[model samples]
Target chain A: MSARSWNLALGLVCVAFALLAVFVWIPHDVSSGVIVQERGQTNVGDAMAPTAWCYALGALGLLLVLTSWRSRPAAKSAVASGPRITAANVRFLALLIFMLVVSLVLMRYAGPVLVALLHALGANVTDYRSLRDAIPWKYLGFVIGGTTLVAGLLALIEGRIRTRQILLALIAVIVIALIVDLPFKHLPLPPNNEL
Target chain B: MTLSLYDYVSIGLQAVFTAHPAFHVLGVPISMAVVMLVAGLLTGLIVGAIPALSGPFAMAVALPILISTFGFSAAALLPTLAFLLGVMKAATLGGSVPAILFNTPGTPDAYLTTFDGYPMARNGQAGKALRVAQFACVSGDTMSDMVLITTAPFLAVFVERYMGFPEKGALIILSMAFIGAAVGASAIKGLISAVFGLFLASIGRGDDQTPRLTFGIPDLANGFSVTVAVVGVLILGEVYQAIEDLAHQHRSKTSPSPVVDRGDQKLHWHERLALMPIIGRSGLIGITVGALPGIGSTLAATLGYAIQKRRHKGAVPMGQGAPEGIAATEAASAAVSGANLIPVLSLGIPGNVAAVFILIAIDTIGGLNPGPSVFTLNQHELNPELVMVIGVFVIMMLGNAINWTLGSMLMRRLGVLQHIPPRIMMPLVLVITVAAIYLQEGKMTSIYFALGFGVIGYLMRKMQMSGLPFVIAYILADDLERLLRQGFSASGADPWFLFSSPLAVAFLLASVVVAFTMSRNPIGKTIIKNADPE
Candidate 1:
């Protein structure tokens, strides 16, 4: 697809995904309503209050983008005169995309080591200079070794005394949260102890 | 209404010593004011120096935390104001690292710095440029802080008498026009961005529970956060450029080396003394522009750079690694950091985005109602003038002290980043950014928001749009809207009343003149010939 089409398609897909997450995915879960109500009361949501002007502005922004996009000439070829896509740029981009994806994935599941490995592999594949040097063992070892050392150091540091204090602080936060939640949670159906 | 300087000093001392223990701890007490200013500055430097972390997001996250901890006192208020001021000064100086070393601007205000700073880096003048910036920033910031302290109370009185809603509204409108005219390569684009910002500000809920434009979703009851919108558009927009970069190849092997000389580049006595004159002129530029509503440090810095560049035309070009360039830009931007506080403290009107978030800290924790009456009386029976004077003195001195000792040490470390590959650095930057967001709110969502905004910010940069003005506009949007609405309501919806105040009218006229004068673009050509008198 053309770059313009690709950008439009990707942007629309992102918007659609956000909408789906907000509406369908959120409402499907039985606990989502409770979460929403609780969140609505939070300071973050309080600041996120909806206004009529957002929609108006969003529409205007859309119009402006479309107008600007239309008035501009079709995309000038981004592919340089040398090659369609250089190996170096590909490596850089691969590494960038790998980091982004791994970060989001790490937030949910795997630890830093696994994420770092994936990033290294991505970097390796995209960074290879010539076809013959695509998987240079020495370079691969360097990327993997360097990434592991950094990740291990971080994990170790996070296990230290300072980390323990931070965890304690987190626990205190949770306790306070539960204490605050208790009255609100039990307010609707309390007084009788049900077995 | 008239508070003497002695009243201010005595009251400040009383509040610091006697008001409450929360305002102090032992003799070297950690009052809310002290905490606020110090924290703001520290956070500003940390966040701004980072590749992805930005000033607005950093400030937004810190304000709530400071409020919860300090619980509003005059003693607390000064510290928070100082924090923001220090942060502005530090961030402006800090952005030079990425700009010079990586050709990437860490902060929006540093974009122009990249133009000259990166070139200098190629020529191995990174250390020199950084040193020049540091000296300039300290000088400008000190002067601006003085201006704020000396003039805020008087300005408050004048504002109380002359500035009703209509005048305030007119001023905001005029500011929007001025910023739109001043920033970016294209005025049309700037205007479009501003209009978009104003439209975004008007979103969410209107007064009196009227739904202006929210769709069916209950979450839409409050409009999308301007922070979200801006982050999405500016940061995320910039991130898109990276994606585009991915589709191509980078040929950076021939890029400039990073072996800069750490030689005897120290400023001489004569050189140090020479800065006094440049500092004064640049300080004036910063304070004057900072006092205006929308124009901020970035523009002030640009004006300073442009003016300084005029002085050394034939002998040395500015964008080609002129020390004067670094000196003027740093001083003016830093100075504005201090001067911007004047309006915020005196009139309760935040001069920029960072200042607006600061208002939340002042109201929630400092227990001070900002604006003209702050100079008269407060709910706490505290002397407003006293708190202000002392706060300015402490913050300004502390800011300078911190810069002199600690700021340089930190900057030296950042200068080393030039050697690291962008491939390694970019990912690490992203990782650190996520950690910072998580630390700020302990929420995964803020990280997501930050990532999303980073992309937008990147795109905005690529489009050659001035993200600073738009961000400033977004921050000021609500205040401007409220003033405009209030002005209409109070004046029976008569548009003519908007220009009723003579001073406001005169200011608006002057704004027009400035806009016209700057729009001509005559200086770019004449600056060279003027420099080469022969």
Candidate 2:
């Protein structure tokens, strides 16, 4: 199939999706069913109405389809010179995509350390000759090491603070009672556990 | 809201560009604005010299977080804007360094410079070319900055005094149509990309603040963050393209070209004087085209080169190391950097991708909306935005001076970056983008959105579609919707409301004509231009 054919398919897909969004997916709010203002009912609809946008998108998609249909075929050699199903390019794209997926999933499942680790691995998968002799490894190591140590310390402090905050309730209550309640009977009774 | 012209003048000048008494040594005061302007200029000189780190790349990496820092206050954004302006100007000049030294144009506008610039390099006049380019670029930028200062206020004043939402909406549509028309030949493809962006904008919320298109995804409740959308679609997309190119080259076994350098070159006063006419003429042309929305520096540069090619017969021959060619191309392209802001400052309509980013920054990050309101004057107080623009103007001037003194020194050292391979650089860029996206919304979920858009961007590029219109359309979407809503709402939903105003009718008609002319390009040239917007 030609590029025009591919464009046609894509344009059709876009039009279908847009139509679905406009007619099926669009939700109605409390006052969406009516636009009557005589009874002092106004703005009873979505603040960012998508109807106009949806129709516009659908029209644009149709135009794309027509454009693709009418698009002229270029020289065969030019088309041949373009990106083909080559192993090297495919592998490169796959690796990048794989890294992106893995990093995104790790973000959902693990802590920042895991995510950072993945990011480092992803960034490190580059041309060896381009980096090895060009950059000073000693400097890179120091920068990387210093960054890791600082990040680790900050994370550790933050984790401790987060985990310990609510767990200190009993000590807080005891201290509060000693300072104020123990001195007098009718001292505005500190709200019990709600405190 | 009324104020005297004198009050306006002082407000424009006093907003931070002037020295403050924060610190003093022997009664010499210092201000952050001047310092920031200098810093920004140096940064621009450095970053702009690198190949493939184009305007969108710079803006995408910075805008998301930068918005948080100042939050749109004119006084604070002014310093940052000064620095940003410096970066932009320097990019136009610095891009030529690689074009001259290694035959690599850093930005689309720099592409034409390489025609003559690289020849100069091959002929052992690389240093001369760089010097010529530096002079031409800065002169062009200064010329356009003057135009912006003189024209923007008058336009804003007119808008403030007269027009309403309907007229603004028509003008915006006119601009958008021109954008679709200006980028490449296919109005269909460009419009398609734009519509896709608009559709993205429409998703996530309804007019009544009800959720739509969220599909019950909790993370998407607030919709895609601007940072995710812009960075993913623009930066990450470029990363994909870079990686793809490297992969192809590696498989094909293409060797990197070795750069040639000749030492000790100086441009004399005689040569500079001879090239003055070319630079001046190109600067004029650039300002004229730059004032129009959608047409950008890249186009301006190409036009400048073509015009000069016809007009002048210079020493060393045209396209064979001619300094006049470099002067014309750099002058015109760099001029657009400042002139691009004309519509943005006056009507809040951004003309190109860079302007779009700035406009978005103003709207989303800054509290003040652009346009006539920014120029508003009152009995009690003058508009701070007017003052801010003046500060911006001052910063642009300072930035130019810094670029002149510092740009030449930095040009020699730029080749150090040429050693970094795309394989290493693109991935690192991706990592930074992911980290930034995560930092902004504090969610891993938005990274996924960015990743998805990145794929779309890669596909758009591979399919030979211009990604610029898509990104610009996305930025303009919110403003477009707001104006459209206001206009339609006030007209009681009458479709013919726009026809009520003569300016509105004129703008819409102009949009139609411009789109028609732009969309009807020769097929081959159109294909080439399609890839140029990057």
Candidate 3:
């Protein structure tokens, strides 16, 4: 892609975003007008700032498009390298998102699943919420989820996972938990507090 | 009741010395603030020595945890601020270790250090180069702090006495415009980033009864967490980029060769004396550049090194094992740590990423506000904010003192830390950041928000957009809006309130001029091109 095309694409995107904000989002979302009068006092409303910014953004976008359109292309040797979003970047992002989703799922559900398993085994167990601050329960989800995320990312970068990497990930999670949990007695680890 | 100047100083000293004692060491009582300062300095050194980690990254991760430990009380403010100041100071000094020992720079500003430092290391003068850097860094930082202490109060008072709402609003517009224009490759894109940040910042509850731009989502009513968004963009965005870089390197089966250390790592007294003049000139340049918003230390280091190189009469060339070169770059880069706070203290405008975090800490901790009001010396009443500012000054001095004594020793020992693979460190950073946010907000939503912002940060980086403007704009958006509204109301509901005063109009015109000039040829792009013509 050339610089001209890059600017054109960026301009179009910005203009689209600005138009949507001005015409659709602001109208549907903001309850107040650009100027509001209440109790016989007139004041700038919440919509005014957002509306101004949107119009400015739109104008700038149009300016960018016009400039890119009017400007001549640089000589071959002087042409600057344009920004590229490669297929590898998409792949990496997709894998990262997948890892994050899996880790979050484990973080949110690991303790509850454990409690349910114990209950089904005829052992007395309370809900995860009640035992969020208790021993073992608080550490379970964070440790499992955190380790998975860390190790998964490591594997993604290294192209393979090893036992040493898993061990390192687990140790890192436990150490982080201790650092966060021990210093402040009232603060609960993640997902546990959510529960 | 009104307190004397002496009384305010005494109160400030007491805040740092006697407020909360963590323990006693050899019949001397150690305050929690002191302990945390030392802890933060050590952590900063370690973080800064690592190639992929930085001071801002450490500050971002440590902020929520520090807040949680200290809680939101007047007493908590000093200790939290102290730790952050410590990190800010030490990290700059520590970043030079990798630059000197290996060819890798731990932070962007340290890239200049490597030009002379790596050559020195390869030539068996690594120890001496480190010593010069350490000395130069500590000296420069202390000098910058002295300037901040002397000038900030007067600047703040001036701003307080003269600037009204209209002027203040115009100043913010000028700041955003200047930042947008100066920071990145394209001024239009940078301004767009700033405006977008403001737009995002507007998506929560305001003074009005109805939440603005929430789209009726319950979660959006409170708006995005500033901490989450900031960390996501600045730290995690970098992490994502690093991970991708590492992945690419892995596929290419290319790895950086390890550097071996074998050098006369010692600086004599005469050598230190010789480098002082260079250090002074560079420190002044750093202080000047850092006082301006959005022009960061990279420009400072480049100007410092270039000027010194032109004036070089040393046995070794400036770029090849010249002690003067190391001293000049290190001094200028380190000096920026303190001088950048000048704007934050006087105008309540953050000039850089570190200042942004400092402002966030003050806002989150909620006892102190950095602005002209902070310097208001009430004749008959005790101004606690003034005392806090003094206390901060005390912390900065302490940080510099520690850097002088122990920083050089730590820098030498940290050469091994440069070997930590980004592939491993980045993942752990991601997890730790997530956990930190979760611990602070105790909500899954905040984590999700942080991740979302992290993606934005990553994309922005790929597109060559500077995140500093976006983050600063986000932080300042509320203040800008408030000032605008106040100005309008004060002007009898006139829509042209921002243009009412000559000073305000001048500021607006300057902003437009800066935007147009810088858009045509951005200083950052020009400096980088000059520094590395390849």
Which one is best on lDDT? 3
- Candidate 3 residue-wise lDDT at A145: 95
- Candidate structures ordered by TM-score, highest first: 3, 2, 1
Writing each residue's lDDT as its tens digit, candidate 2 over B1-534 gives 567767766765666545443466686665667766666666666556677576566666555445444444555576556555666777777788778877777777888888898898887777788899998998999999989988887888898777887788777778777676666436666666776777787566445444556777767766787667877777788787776665445233553366565775798888889888999999987898788776678777887888999987766778888899999999998888788898988887777667766776666646456677766655567666666666677778778877788887778787666555444445445555654454445465676789789988887766656676777777777777777766766887666777879988998898777655665556324423632455
Docking class of 3: medium
Q: What is the C-alpha local distance difference test score of each model?
A: 0.54, 0.66, 0.85
Q: Which ten residues in a row have the lowest lDDT in candidate 2 chain B?
A: B523-532
Which docking class does model 2 fall in?
A: incorrect
Model 3, residue B507: C-alpha shift (Å): 0.7
The candidate 1 chain B region of ten consecutive residues with least summed lDDT is: B525-534
Taking the candidates in order, what DockQ does each have?
Answer: 0.05, 0.12, 0.74
Per-residue lDDT tens digits of candidate 3, residues B1-534?
Answer: 667888888989988987789999897889999888998899888888898898898899989888888889988988998888888888888889999888789878889999999898887777888888899999989989998999888888878888999998899999999888787667777788888888898898577787989878788888998898899888888888888888778343454455455745567788889999999999998898888888778888888899999999999988888989989998998888788899898888998888888888889998888887788778787889999899999889988898888897788899889778787888899988998898788898898899989899888876667787888999998999998877777787898888888999999999998877764565546642322100
Q: Put the candidates in lDDT order, highest first.
A: 3, 2, 1
Q: Which segments of model 2 are wrong by more than 4 Å?
A: A27-49, A70-73, A78-94, A107-195, B1-12, B18-29, B71-74, B251-264, B376-380, B521-531
Best by TM-score: 3
lDDT, residue B129, model 2: 84
